[model samples]
Target: MEFIALDILPFSVVDDVCFRRLVEHRYTLPSRSYFSDVSLPELHSIVETYIHELLAMGVTAISFTTDIWTSDVSPISMRSLTAQWVNEDFVLRKAVLHAQECAGSHTAAAISMAFEKMFETRKNPKNKVHAVLRDNAHNTTKALEECGVASLPCMAHTSGNR
Candidate 1:
């Protein structure tokens, strides 16, 4: 499961004969259905728990970065939110809080609502979010503003380096 998820390999890779032969000596690979159905959900739950625990500990302030983009080949639009903070040990930690498909238009309201949902679901307090760094798109800026979140423009976007 870790091999598939970490390497971003297709589920079908588990069924490849050569791949199976390579690892069968020490491990048994489950079916693709098992990965899609069982392993993935379990992995998600474990990671979610870890993130919640980390945030509930000594973390006081979190900086966020969010963006939305549409695929050119497909009509799918995705919005992602990432959180970064220094841990109690003074080590920097970063995690992607959300990366989900957007259903409709990328309006300010939609973006803000999505962010709120992610924070709420993760059990992270809004007050803990120090600031958001994002592209200077009107909708994105307005979205964070609507959520009462402080935002800074991404220098890459501002300088046209993105």
Candidate 2:
């Protein structure tokens, strides 16, 4: 529980410390020490393992949302694509998704190649492709088309004709 609290709970380092202390006192058990032993990189890998499992279970689809933005006040844009999917259990309806670093300057061929490479790296190739989802940009649409995959524009994104 402490491990989960530290990693996933909505709290800061201070909150974590307070929560851990409170729990320790209430339950008379040692607070979680695992955080001290695990590195951030290791935690990322562990989380990625869970992500892969979710992907393979049809919990996420190939259709992605993308945007460009800058971290600083001055605009230096970056583009990325994310895969999304849903997991429907008895009481919970959760969505799983992830984004990958990508270049805005890349051509259709390049984007397609990059995505293809990404798919190859995934443990389940079949789950990585959602035949119906489409790319918003014309270049990405063409790239998706080259794969012999049907691509449709996101209807929600279409300009409203007033």
Candidate 3:
């Protein structure tokens, strides 16, 4: 039940007979409120621990990708940050660093601050962030410059308003 909701699935999934049969009566799903109060926070903690473990794996260089967007149904804009790295085994690894509300005005400074906050906990000495890949918007490019890191334009940023 908790993992369903965390994965952005419907909470009522556990109510399905097929799902219950799949679990085979070995576990009872917790209520929505119980999941909210206990399971969600615990799961977040677990993920945080996992992220730390991943970052500590001596990756040499990391990159970031980010975007901000708003919905027609809501008056708020949100930003998502993703981290990319090549591991010791030479496999590319990616992780979602954050999905957070873009507070204050949508200025270059504000977005720069958002980048700073996103990287607050990812200061592994073994890894160096090479660049941030983002859209080629005026504000976004300016924000990247303000963050003082090398910035690369995303190849798919063809939409003018993005």
Candidate 4:
């Protein structure tokens, strides 16, 4: 209960009157230090395990989508990648895989390295990822060529061009 509470809700919520009353003061609340040291690591471990399970599931091939953007609040540019695949149960599953800071400028070489690191989470990501869907930036196309993955332009963006 403490783990779930701390994992999902803000730290200040631990002191909420309603939350305190609901517990009836039976269980001793875990301190914030515990959450930082214990619960957070556990959460990361569980998520990594789940991702491996997904990779093990029977699927023809996986597709990916990625884009780069810089938030107004942050000086660094970041790339976001999402995975899409049909699961063993014949259900389509989609997950946002990563949002990581770009290593350097958004050149083809740099983007290719970023893509490799993101896919490394699944190990042999190049073989599993059939293609990467991205906006029609010259760098994206060049990166896909260098990485040996097919480049698919976002249909929405292509259609807009038409």
lDDT of each: 0.90, 0.54, 0.77, 0.79
List clash counts for every candidate, in order. Answer: 0, 1, 0, 0
Ranked by lDDT, the better of candidates 1 and 4 is 1
Worst 10 residues of 3 by lDDT: 118-127
Q: Write the candidate numbers in order of decreasing lDDT.
A: 1, 4, 3, 2
Clashing pairs in 2: 60-85
TM-score of 4: 0.81
Q: Give the TM-score of candidate 2.
A: 0.55
Error of 2 at 56 (Å): 3.3
* Cα lDDT of model 3 by residue, 38-139, tens digit: 777888888878977887788668888888987899988999978888888998889887887886788898888877766775553322778888988788
Residue pairs clashing, model 1: none
Q: Highest lDDT among the candidates is held by which one?
A: 1
For candidate 1, write residues 54-139 as lDDT tens digits: 98788999999888888899999888899999999998999998998888978899888888898888787889989999999999
Error of 1 at 144 (Å): 0.6
The parts of candidate 3 lying over 4 Å away from their true place are: 1-7, 15-28, 122-127, 158-162
For each candidate in turn, the TM-score is 0.93, 0.55, 0.82, 0.81
Output the lDDT of residue 7, model 2.
Answer: 69
Candidate 2 per-residue lDDT, tens place, 1-162, comes to: 345546675324534656657565556532335343454446667767877766656454445454434467754545454555555442222223335556556578876776566556645364445653543667777776665555667676565421
Stretches off by above 4 angstroms in model 4 are 1-11
Instruction: Supply the global lDDT for candidate 3.
Output: 0.77
